[model samples]
Target: MDPLSDILSVLKLRSYVSGGFDASGEWAVHFGSHEGIKFHAVVTGECWVAVDCEAPVKVKAGECFLLARGKPVRLASNMAAEPISLQFLLPPTHDGRIVTYNKGGEFLSIGGYFTLADGQADMLLNVLPPFIHIRNEPSRATIRWCVERMRQELCDPQPGDFVVAQQLATMVLVEALRLHLSARDRDEVGWLFALGDERMRAALSAMHASPGSPWTLQLMAKKAGMSRTTFATRFKEKVGLSPMEYMTRWRMILAADRLTNSTETLSEIGHSLGYNSEKSFGTAFKRVMNYPPRQYAKL
Candidate 1:
């Protein structure tokens, strides 16, 4: 599989279409800091999104913004509009249903939050910008489809609304990240850009496709078609980790998923990732996860 698909497949991304809002006249809403990644898509009208100390971003109809790190942001009809805390506005048992806020206004939007099941999401996804904005244009057909499907599903709930909406939200996130990555400079020194490089892409695909492989520095360099020193330097420069470091981390991440989702013995899991013994695998897992495999599996 491709690098982006490989990373996302193991991340176990799940999205929830939480209630949305429709506001008109003069109004503002503060969705304070949250843990899950949050997003808002402008379905109609326009509004300004203001994060602390930054200028407000004007979001017109058909535009969308994703708060990848769940940063605190305020949406307002105007810069000076007094805002109400979103925490106070929603009902106590706010089910995952669309709700209009300050009804009778022009700005209309659907919003939601998503979570990554993988505990190592920060390490794997930190290369992304804090916020990703995608304009509604022909070039962004995938994003447009996600936004439209999510809006349609949420507005008119069906028998399997939860599953359908969640899937749509997942697609939205993937498309958003793809667009974000494609917009960056080709020479950017990050894993996101590294995924686009032919040389680095070959190495990454090799590492991901076979985490259990007894990959040596020479073998990895050969895969990238570069000398050992050149490969090491470029790998570190682009991916921010030595090749083996990434491999070990990836193995641990895969091990964590297996431990959580499967009924495998510790030794079996260890050997699957090229560990000789349960003790060695446990040590590595603890170092990366700050917990033993047995303990983490229960969580």
Candidate 2:
């Protein structure tokens, strides 16, 4: 019940590469705000990435960038170039190699997106920065490796190519978050920050590991080796939610995952998540997800 892994599992991350580009000279591509996150990698050459209200960042080969806030961004060979709409530049190709060759200084780059459809996705992702840049470093070998693997998987296909590519993309995300967490300031507050706290981590692990348990303030405080009042205050300060609220949130996410991916009955799902009855679980699910479990399962 790793907290980060649990969050990702509940979020149901779906990732795919839009296309690859081999361009040179002055070219700019605008990617509009999307429902999920976006990423770019410099495979062979260098490029500039500009997010709204932020200075342009130069990324070279072996480096990657992530946009978490669904903000519009522009990637270009030069800042002054008239940009081309990414939609036109990389038209949707259901099943093919999306490679484009252009004249000028050759620059090979890969771009992709990660989508999360879970009702609780925003709550989990709201803590992340709008943009995260991973530079080429000895410690970032795994990130570079994932990027290269994804590039090869896209450029060539074998058995289970989609699954393999998606897995590699997920690895990139995990590594990126790990790096960001390591570098984040101590004052920064979020899920990762909560995980960094010794007391909060223990309480969170307990909740995640045993979601079916009847978690209470006293129980969580004991788990954190603190008084009830101290634990409650610190938990809210770090996680931005009360203990029971976070528990309910996780329970709903777990229930949603079960509903969508399993054939288990409502009663079974509810019982597994500590709900007293199917009706109670359905009410909670509807409140959190805005739809009943039965209806959402069909969706």
Quote each prediction's TM-score: 0.90, 0.86
Per-candidate local distance difference test: 0.82, 0.83
Q: What is the lDDT of residue 217 in candidate 2?
A: 93
lDDT for predicted candidate 2 compared with the true structure: 0.83
TM-score of 2: 0.86
Off by over 4 Å in 1: 91-94, 185-188, 295-299
Model 2, C-alpha of 140: deviation from truth (Å): 1.0
Clashes by residue pair, model 1: 24-105
On lDDT, the leading prediction is 2
lDDT score of model 1?
A: 0.82
How many collisions per candidate?
Answer: 1, 0
What tens-digit string does per-residue lDDT give for candidate 2 at 1-299?
68888888788788887656778767888888877788788888899999987999999999998899988899888989988886676446546344563653478877777898656678557988888999899999998888788778778878887788777877888888888887778878766779878899999999899999988899999999999999999988888889888888889888888888888999999999998888998999999888899898888
Clashing pairs in 2: none
